[model samples]
Target: METTLRKSDEHESISDGNELRHGSVVIAAITSCTNTSNPSVMIGAALLARNALEKGLKVKSFVKTSFAPGSRVVIDYLKDAGLMDYLEELGFHLVGYGCTTCIGNSGPLKNEFINDIQDKDLVVASVLSGNRNFEGRINPHTRVNYLASPPLVVAFALAGTVSINMEKEPLGTDLEGNLVFLRDVWPNSKEITKLIDKFVSTKLYTKEYSEIFKGWDLWNELKPPKEDVYQWEENSTYIREPPFFKDFPMEKPPTTDIKGARVIALLGGSVTTDHISPAGTIPLDMPAGRYLISKGIDIDNFNSFGSRRGNDEVMMRGTFGNIRIKNLLTNREGGWTSYHPTKEIMPIYDAAIKYIDSNTPLIVIAGNDYGMGSSRDWAAKGTQLLGIKAVIAESFERIHRSNLVGMGVLPLQFKEGESATSLGLTGEETFDIYGIREIEPLSELDVTARGINEEELKFKVIARLDTPIDIEYYQNGGILHTVLRNMIKK
Candidate 1:
């Protein structure tokens, strides 16, 4: 089973850490197209919420509950059915007209709850009908997640613990001390059918979505920069022209060997793009957050990593910055890397800056299934900006491997059954990649590393440029650079 799932009916919510603990549902959201698009499900959820609230079913006050519909038609249907108030009364109010939980847009939980979890290390959870449930994708604080239907989300919030069986457990006690189970509150099929038939109007969807292309009035009024070429600004915080095409040439670049490259991070298997370049809420202490703060931006307005993808400075700072990332280089958790031979502990961005200033090239060594999720472009762009000349991994995902090549970073794969662990890499060694002076697509490269103990190790990796076009993209320092150079010549 995937690590993300927990059978609310069977598993014990408490860990063996020697304490009795209830599984806390910190987030309970009926907020995804998965359910909201269906008239039957949305009305059913509201009806269930209505029943629970009337019976005095109470959820933990700390649970960050929400309801986001896919379109305005959902709100219109609920309102026409007079069931919108029923949901809001129980705190499942409409929050947005888009996807939420699955995308890590469940928003922020209460400060009190966040502080409590951090202080106590509570094994928290979220019950959402969202499609994706990668480890940290659902708020880094919530560890266990259960994918349920819209009404089940409400049921779990009332039950307040994933450890309980909805069929067998009492959600809460009523005024007369009556037990309230999920079955007692579940809406009957006839009621849902009647509400769907009565309230769903074709105009609701057509009217709400018609102007989507023209966009909002504010966006329509927004102006664009006048110049064909972007005006590079040194002080702009949100975005600035990248330096990849600076002094670029129309002709192809030389294939070059990389020597004395330092390992920026040593990672383990299933290292998703989220781990490489996260797009969630940025912590105030991370390098990207500090940079935003230094620009006098308030913490609340700092936005998210996804909102700042156009900004190379911020994205570069956010590379390998996921709070859950486990980098083996410094032996500490979360984006910390030792600055080369100096052994100074600092943020990955800071270490990269120091290395760039001193002309020390960087690379990463990883276990299997590297660059697996989100297919984010920044994962490659940021890696290049961090001075990573190449990435040597036991395996690679298709898109990210291509993105790395498109960003002028070489992608290398270890022979089967060979990896950093198999070769005993400590991540503190100086690496050398040879045979690049006349490199070809799908070629083999020799690798050597010198550790702190002055021991040298040698290995071989297959160049991952699968085609002549990929090699061209890499040699010209990425696809964008190649495009720009051609444009300038014309």
Candidate 2:
């Protein structure tokens, strides 16, 4: 995590070898749909916080603590059991009704705190009970993201760093100037289980969920643009008419060999959909921001990439636009990368535009666990828009690989004990992936990488078209395109 975040981006960042700088806990959130749905953990966290406050333990002043329960029932049960007051006293307050800290919806860190993190090169930590702890998926500056349980999040908030072995070291000094360790306030499992068993009932869930559809007053009251088919607004920045179906004929594209494919971005392991299908803040200087400005949208009105996903122009430009994304082709981080042949440093979107203009097919070469984060379709969709015909990686995450096929992007796996690094790929090599004419589920295919000096290295990759249906999706250009064709046939 430290290695990735330290790279230079839009804002100046810490360089390597300063990994052990000042450590602090900037955000400690017990927020997510996962743990909050489990009553034992939510009640357990409140109980733990209650015990800690009684013992004069306080969370670090800098730690931004929030409790975003999964639903209203979780809140009701905690309040009914008299645990909300205890939880609030120890700094965990209800911030939002839905995903708050997780999904990078975590609101701003204080300017002073932000300055401290940047100026001091402090390696701050965020202890989130939320599922994803992928680099840059949480707050960008919070480098060390720990996926802990709700109770542990509260504990880390009080302790203030992952540096300490809480069992061995003191979290902080209590009122009497005595060092306090975790055991001093830690609630045992038996008590937590007993409290959960006594308080949580099926009646609470039944009653809360019974009116789920009817009670969304805001949604029910919303008047959509009354039309059977959505009227695509050309001037709207949020959405546009999808071009995939509009510009092309209703015919399956031929499965031709991908030759002279340029490597757009060379990535290491664990590149999340968040990196590709960006969600949070759009900087005024980035590609998406510039495009929005051209559309008469101010920087402040740029919103987030997530809110504007319906716009292919913005979504395509926002691909690899994440401020924290690391494109290994350049020594620096950010959404910028060196456009091959030109060696000119430009935003990823600009280079992709250039490549598309020149009719160059693009491909991403990556290490293990490529596309590992959220199961977002736009991740694959964005790749296809960028002209990426194939992805040759050491391995792939299951759903993402399927999404790639759904977008008609070929997914390939490196033969065991082989990787881009192992094969000495520097992201400059022109790759030719052939022998996919009769592509099958898990069939072996050839990938030949040729250097500028004309030196060649060849390897085999397994086609990750998991099923025959997946192959059909690929042949028809995409899953949606295939479905449209099937409907026409019927």
Candidate 3:
């Protein structure tokens, strides 16, 4: 199934391998859960944009600047600050309500700008205040995207390029093409404080969120069960109660003498949660597509994975990626799964299913700084649902490591100087850990990797089971499960 970005034919949609683009980035959106969650940051962005416009700063003709705030109160405060018009004048339009550019819901790039980007081979970048700048999430045309503060996003939009650091460097040329430095219009903390005090009010939270708690039209329509505990719905793929909902096993899991288990996927360095559970547009051919079709929703009607987070079927199927993962094992680009014995190519989700049925425990191997970005619990939840027993990386992001522990997935760190590649791991390798339940931070886990053929490798991975709280969370399956169980007991 070929996945084409509905926007334009400017950049080719990557089916497998790295397909980067050279385009003057047309969409410069400042959106993300991080900054939008903070009222002051969003207000800061709005004020900067307003001040920029007053100083006769204009966004590049090819650029489209938009602000998609995470919370509704952000917009209310922006309005209260009277900076909405200034933002709009600068082409910063309000597109949708939730997680827009951050999750790659950048909508469509204008046809003219898309054409110019392709023709010129522009190396366009999206400067967002949110975390997670994984290659293809923003827009297909955007070749390189950088994460920044909300104020920096505004500065980038005014300057319209990623060539220089706006803090010290000049944005672009003046009328004579002379350099225009960022300091020319940079707002001081004192100025930002005045705006914050004038516009952003604590009252807005009570005003804006009061209605949000009233529930949306969708929530009102959902039929609730009469019982406190939800009866498991077998066929419904949306929200099935997980297997961990049952009582914990009386006995601990076998720590050693585990039989052969093949590698599920061979990952690379800096593989963030976005690579693990990308919340982008769902393709028509994925397992998620089939599930949605069964529910009578056509491919076009299919929105995003983030919107369907409660649905285990959609999320678990769309876990790794939609059509944009660069899998190294099969040497096939873009989200294909490689079978162990056969060393064959299949869809990633389907491959996981095969391993699950065979009772093969799954593990993800990656380089340094794995699972960085966002406090999104789904990043951990989906992987756990996908049956990934463990993740071995050189380093771990703070939130995601905690999240992995919460979901009962063992997180291991590679010893310094040792990497997944250094260990010569392919997707066909089988692994085992001895004395896992008794594992402590930096405790070595004996690991043995044997390929489908005669090749075998061995190494020791460090357990990143940081604290007693983390161990408790893992024991309880996940934070949600732990909280629910405690509530029930009370």
Index of the highest-TM-score prediction: 1
Better of 2 and 3 by TM-score: 2
Ranking of candidates on TM-score, top first: 1, 2, 3
- Please provide, for model 2 over 345-391, each residue's C-alpha lDDT reduced to its tens digit, 9 standing for 90 to 100: 99988998899999999998888888887898888888899888898
Against the true structure, candidate 2 reaches a TM-score of: 0.88
lDDT of 1 by residue, 1-490 (tens): 1232345444564521112244678889987775778888888888998899889877667777898877888898899899999888878888887767777777888887788788877778888987766666678788777798898888877766666656666788787899877778899999999888788977777887786797878988999899998886778777778767667666776777998899999999999987887676777898998989998889989877777777887889988987678888766778888887678899999999988998999999998999997788888989998999999999999999999999999999999899999899988889999998778888999999999888999999999999999988888888998787778779
Candidates 1 and 3, the one with greater TM-score:
1
Would you estimate the TM-scores of all the predictions?
Answer: 0.90, 0.88, 0.73
Backbone clash numbers for all candidates listed? 0, 0, 8
Candidate closest to the true structure, highest lDDT: 1
Distance from true location, Cα of 211 in model 3, Å: 5.7
lDDT of each: 0.83, 0.82, 0.71
TM accuracy, model 3: 0.73
Query: Which pairs of residues collide in candidate 2?
Result: none
